[model samples]
Target: MTTPTDFLLWVRGPGFDIALVVFILGVIIRLLEVLVLGRKHDYSEPRGGELGPGLKTVVTRTLPETGSFKRAPFTVIGGYIWHIGFFISLFLFVPHIELINATLGLSWPGIASNLVDAVAAVTIVTLIAMLFSRLTHPVKRYLSGPEDYLTWLVTFLPMLTGYLAYHRMIDPYPLVLGLHILSVEVLMIVFPFTKLMHAFTFFIARWYNGAMSGRRGVQS
Candidate 1:
């Protein structure tokens, strides 16, 4: 008979090893792309043909007045909540924490089980809402391509499966866990080539914006 121990072994051994390798390779490829092929723009001047005012303008005046935030607040908020919750669940979930404690001798602060459950639920819901918004919103609909929707599907499935595994619903816990791991493996395999690449590029873009504003004597 299949036991919890058996399932745990599969996850911690081959499943984890494969996931780790894929994650590492995906990150390396994404970084290489950014380093080698990413776009280069001179943001030294503002959108208008001027020196973008000054550092004060870049820092306080121009940047804050930018309408991008108001254009898509739902996407922004959903993205933030989903990401934060996913990372928290990944690093702090009990089983994962136990694994880390065993393999790496690292200990993280433990959260109550109920709180963890709540976080996972919120993450999944927000992600779903974001997906729905993408489908229904006119602007998002206009902008989204097949790859965009596919990326969201790929990203959302693992989270949903993982949460199901945690709750031990439907299939046996072991099977659900395996499926979760597999979904994540698929995501890792496709990370560098998909819209998911934003995970790696977002920070770079933010930094570039900040730097350009600084150089131009504008407030960001």
Candidate 2:
């Protein structure tokens, strides 16, 4: 019989190490493939050119427009709310920050646990809202497949499990904690292989688009 202690050890030890290795190497490999796939040279003469405009475009995209909020209120609101909560819980939660501090020899002030809990609850709510939208909206529903929902679930599990464990909603504390760590490892392993790659590729893709448009002499 596997004791809770053994399960916890596995999750925190080899399981985590394997997940980290796979996550790092997979990200590196995928990133290299994208970078080395070199684009065709654009030989056209420019009417105007400023890399600044491209950079501006990249920066601007980070902030959604009021028009977009009006157009897709739920999506815009849910997106911002979820991301805010996600980051707060991921980085500011006491345990998570402590883990990072221990691992990287870096540290930041952690927020109050109550605040982290609230943010995590918000994250769960927003994620559910987003998932519901995906299931009900015609365009999103049509565009989505198993992989899309799978990625969403994979992304959602660690948050949900952590929330449960934090509150002791689950009886066996060790098992729940182990499950939470396992979910994170699962997410790391699945990350590069799924649409979740957006976590990393989004920046590169945006930079390329911005640079190309900037070189074209058009204000992006």
Candidate 3:
């Protein structure tokens, strides 16, 4: 008979192994394709330095520009809150910190559980609000399609499952916990192939834009 403990063990062992393998290999392949698939010669004379602006933009774009913030204050502000909260919960929560310590032999002090829980809830709320805005806003609605919604759900599910598991909201706690871990595995497998690549490509795209614009004597 399949027990909750068995389910949890499989998720933590084989499921995790599969997810990590796929995530890492897929990411590497995708990166190689992006970086190696295209090349061109730009013979135009330089009007300004490229490296400085490239580095600058990599840092600067993390904060919304004045015009962007003015145009989308809610998005800009909400994005910051969501990002900060999500990262804090992911990195600083006790369980996650302990997992890192166990797996990688690195350790750090985690924040209080209550604080992390509060941040997680807030980030989840922000994500929901952002999704609602996307659905309601005319421009965003027009631009978004099924993939956007699908990505949103997949991205959101791990957090939801993790929260539920942590709180033991359902019976068979081990099963629920396994579900959470499995949800994360699903996310990892899909991440490299989805818009989630933006987590990495954002820097490259910003740098290229900044460098090109700098060469054109414009600050981007």
Clashes of 3: 0
> 1 or 3: which has the higher lDDT?
3
lDDT of 2 by residue, 121-198 (tens): 989989998999999999889999999998989879999999999999887899899999999999999988887898
lDDT of 3 at 24: 94
Q: Per-residue alpha-carbon lDDT of model 3 for 1-220, expressed as tens digits? A: 1999998999999999999999999988988899997658689898999899999999988878899899999989988998898789889999999999999989999999989888889888999999999989999899998888877887788878878877889779998999988988998998998998898889889999999999888888
What 10-residue stretch in candidate 1 is worst by lDDT? 48-57
lDDT of 1 by residue, 122-172 (tens): 999998899889889988899999998888888888878887887888466
lDDT of model 1, residue 8: 60
The CA root-mean-square deviation of candidate 2, after full C-alpha superposition on the true structure, stands at 1.6
Error of 2 at 209 (Å): 1.7
**Would you give me the overall lDDT of model 1?**
0.74
Q: List the residue pairs that clash in candidate 3.
A: none
lDDT of 1 at 89: 82
